[model samples]
Target chain A: SQTIHQWPATLVQPVGSPLSLECTVEGTSNPNLYWYRQAAGRGLQLLFYSVGIGQISSEVPQNLSASRPQDRQFILSSKKLLLSDSGFYLCAWDRDRGSPLHFGNGTRLTVT
Target chain B: AQTVTQSQPEMSVQEAETVTLSCTYDTSESDYYLFWYKQPPSRQMILVIRQEAYKQQNATENRFSVNFQKAAKSFSLKISDSQLGDAAMYFCAYRSAGLNAGNNRKLIWGLGTSLAVNP
Candidate 1:
């Protein structure tokens, strides 16, 4: 069975501070990883996705960025946090195209 | 770009009653997949059901099922015997079957519908 782990289950940061949220998957190799932000009523927004090592694709232009350093490790980072950056962030992984993505528990980040 | 639409922002249902959440999508791609995900107050998304564009039979899981109209491009989720535990945000998602190296495998999401169950 495959499982995903996301760190810093909850985070609070002052404005203009750096941000780093990590995600790692177990029992899978070279899986497609994705990062999404869920805001109340607006739905889950796709922030970033990676197909392979060191390959990252961004969906919407924002203050955040994502990287795939290893086959099972993915990181979401930001140089400086904005108030609008605060939301429930999720990490997901899928075996291939058209497959259902398995998600991590998620990390709640609040930028004050 | 493909788009998924969930018109109902919110819905209320009595316990033991059946509720249907509607979803529609627009896409030019012939091969694709539609999915329904449930997000409870805990904020974690779970797959409720899935429907392939080529499957004629609707998919069902326990109390959950889908009414898939491929020609109409509509996928609606029906929850039987609604429970208080079922109160949550439900999202409709779409994915393309064709592999695009540049586009990758991404899920196009709907705005979501808030389902409220009354005891």
Candidate 2:
């Protein structure tokens, strides 16, 4: 069975701080990974996705960027965070082009 | 571009009753997938049910089932014998099967409906 590991389940960061949220998949090879953020009482917003190592696509333009340094590792990073960046961040993985996404437990990031 | 719509923002159902959550989508592609995801207080999205575009028969999972209308472009989730554990935010999502850049099987989601199961 595939599993996604997302770190720092709850984070409180000051404005202008650098942010690095990590996600990794186990039990799957070359899986598609995505980063989505959900604001309170709002729908999910896809921030970034990666099909393979070093191949990252930005779905929405924002203060965040994603990178796939390794086959199973997808990282969401920000040079300096903004208050608007506060939200529930989730990492997901899927494969074979059409499977429904399997999500991680998610990280609650609060930018103060 | 594909989009999903969940008409109801919130709905309430008493225990052991039935509740239906409506969803409709706009798309030009015929081959795709529709899904209903439940987000409990835990905040992790869990897949409740899925419907394929080609399958005419509705999909079911234990107590959960979908009313999939291809021509109407509608997909509704029905929860029978609703329980307190079913109280959560339900989201409808659409995923295109086409292999394209940006498509990457990205799911276009609807603003979820908050489902409240009353005792």
Candidate 3:
């Protein structure tokens, strides 16, 4: 069985501070990884997705960026955080194009 | 471009009763995938059911089932004997089956519908 792990279940940071959220999957290799954000009582917005290492496709232009350093390790980072950047961040992985996505326990970041 | 639409922002149903949440999508591609994901207050996305465009038979999982109308572009989720645990934000998503790289496997999501189960 495959499992996804996301760190810092809840985060509180001041504005203009740097941010790093990591996600990793075990028991799978060369899986598709994705990062998504959800506002309070709203739908999810796709942030970034990677099919392989060193390859990232961003869905929207924003203050955040994503990277795939290792085959199963994905990181979401920001040089400077904005008030609007605070939300529920989720990491997901899939085996293939037709497979269902498996999500990790999200990180709730609060930017003050 | 493909788009998923869930018109109802919120819906409530009595416990043990049945409820149906509607979803509609627009796509030019013939082969694709549709999914229903449930997000409870915890906010973890849980895949409830999936339907393939090429299949005519509707897909069912335990108490959850989907009414897939390919021609109508409608895929609705029906929950039988709804429970309080079923209360959550339900999202409809579409994925293209194209073999192209980059954006082929990305899921197009809807605004989602919040379901409330009343006892």
Candidate 4:
């Protein structure tokens, strides 16, 4: 079965600090990966999606960025974090285009 | 510009009763996909059900089902015999369909409906 793993279930970072959140997929190869953020009492907002290595499409413009350094490995990073960056971050994988996605437990990021 | 709307921000239902959460989308594409995702307190996005645009019949999974009206562009989820575990934030999503050189599965999420199952 396919599974998604995200590390550091919760994070607390200071403003202007660098950030890195990693997501890895097991039992799948070259799957579509996506990063999403959900604010408190709000819906999910798609941040970035990668179809293949070194290929990323950003949905919302912000201080955050995403990279697919390796197949099945996706990373969300930021050179300088903002207060607005604080939210719950979720990583999900899709087998192919127009397919349903499987998601990770998510990382709760608190930027103070 | 594709958009999804979930009118109800919060909803409550009695346990063992049925509740329907409404969702509507605005799109020019004839072929697309609709989905309902449940997010528990753990924050894991779980696919509750999905409906393909071309399919006339609704999609069902155990106690969860979707009433997909392609013409009205409305897709609603009906939970039968709702349980306490069913309480969560339900998000309605939409994805465009096309065999593109790029990706065809970028999901547009609605504001979400918070379902609270009361005892």
Candidate 5:
């Protein structure tokens, strides 16, 4: 069975601070990883996705960026956070194309 | 551009009853996939059901089933014998099956419908 782990279930940081959220998958290799953000009582917005190491595709232009440093490790980072950056960030992984995505417990980021 | 729509913002159902959540989408591509995801208060996205555009028959998983109307581009999720645990935010999503280079696998999501089950 594969499992996804995301850290810092809830985060509170001041404005203009750096942000780093990590997601890792176990029991699978070369999986597709994705980052999605959801606003309060709203739908999810695709932020980024990676097919392999050092390959990332950004869906929206914003303050956040994603990196796939390893086969199963994906990190979402930002040099400086904005107030609009606050939301529920979710990390997901899939075995291959046309596979259902498995998500990790999201991190609720609050940029004050 | 492909887009998904879920008109219902919130819905409620009595325990042990049946409820259907509607979803509609617009796309020019013929090959594609549709999915319904559940997001609980824990904020974990769980796959409820999926339907391939090429398949004519609807897909069912335990108590959850989907009404897939490919011609109309409509996919709705139906919950039978609804339980309190079924209460959550339901989302409809679409993914293009075309073999494109950039974002053929990216999922486009609709505004979710919050489902509440009363005990």
Candidate 6:
């Protein structure tokens, strides 16, 4: 069975600080990965998605960026965080197009 | 860009009662898929039901079922005999069907509807 793991389940960062959240999937190779952000009482916003290593497509331009360094490793990063950047971050993987995405437990990020 | 809308921000139902949550979407693509995901207090996204545009018959999963209106582009979830565990945020999602044909497989999600179950 495939499983996803995300680190720093809860994070507290200050404004202008650098941020990094990692997501890794097990039991799958070359799967499509996605990064999503959900604000309190808001909808899940697609931030970035990648089909292969070194290829990242962003949905909404923002301070955050995503990268797929390895086949099953995806990272979301920011050089300088903003207060508005605070939210719950989720990592998901799908076998291919039109397939259901499996989401991670998610990391709650708070920017002060 | 495709957009999904969940009109009800919140809904409550008595235990063992039936409740339906409405969802509508806008898309020009002919082939696509609709999904309903349940997020419990734990916040894990669980697939409740899925409907393919080509299928004429509705899909059902035990207590959960979907009323798929392809012509109207509407997908609604019906939970029969709702339980306490059913109290959670339900999200409606849309994905293009022709991914191998250049359609992005990214899921377009709605704001979500919070469902409450009363005993």
Name the best candidate (by DockQ).
Answer: 3
Off by over 4 Å in 5: none
CAPRI category for model 2: medium
- How would the candidate models be sorted by lDDT, starting from the highest? 3, 2, 5, 1, 4, 6
**Chain B global fold similarity (TM-score) for predicted model 6 against the true chain B:** 0.95
Which lDDT tens digits does candidate 1 get at residues A11-63?
A: 99999999999999999899999999987567888899998999998989988
Q: Candidate 6, residues A1-112: lDDT per residue as tens digits? A: 9999998799999999999999999998999998999988888988998989999988889899988989999999999999999999999999866678899999999999
Q: Could you give the DockQ of candidate 1?
A: 0.75
Task: Tell me how far the alpha carbon of residue A6 in candidate 2 is from the true structure, in angstroms, after superposition.
Answer: 0.4
- Expressed as tens digits, the lDDT of each residue in A4-91 for candidate 5 is 9998899999999999999999998999999999999999988999989999999999989999989999999999999999999999
Superior by DockQ: candidate 4 or candidate 5: 5
Per-candidate local distance difference test: 0.92, 0.93, 0.94, 0.92, 0.93, 0.91
Recovered fraction of real interface contacts per model: 0.66, 0.66, 0.74, 0.83, 0.77, 0.57
**True contacts reproduced, candidate 6:** 0.57
Chain A vs. true chain A, TM-score per model, equals 0.97, 0.97, 0.98, 0.97, 0.98, 0.98
- Across A9-100, the per-residue lDDT of candidate 3 in tens digits comes to 99999999999999999999999999999999888888999989999999999989999999999999999999999999999999987889
lDDT of candidate 3 over B22-86, digit per residue (tens): 99999989999999999998989999999999999999999999999999999999999999999
Which should have the higher lDDT, number 2 or number 3?
3
Better of 1 and 6 by DockQ: 1
True contacts kept of 4: 0.83
List the pairs of residues colliding in candidate 4: none
Span of 10 residues, lowest total lDDT, candidate 1 chain B: B97-106
lDDT of 2: 0.93
Clashing pairs in 2: none
User: Which parts of model 2 have CA positions greater than 4 angstroms off?
Assistant: none
The candidate that achieves the highest lDDT relative to the unseen native structure: 3
Interface RMSD, candidate 5? 1.0
Docking class of 1: medium
lDDT by residue (B61-83, candidate 4, tens digit) is 99999999988999999999999
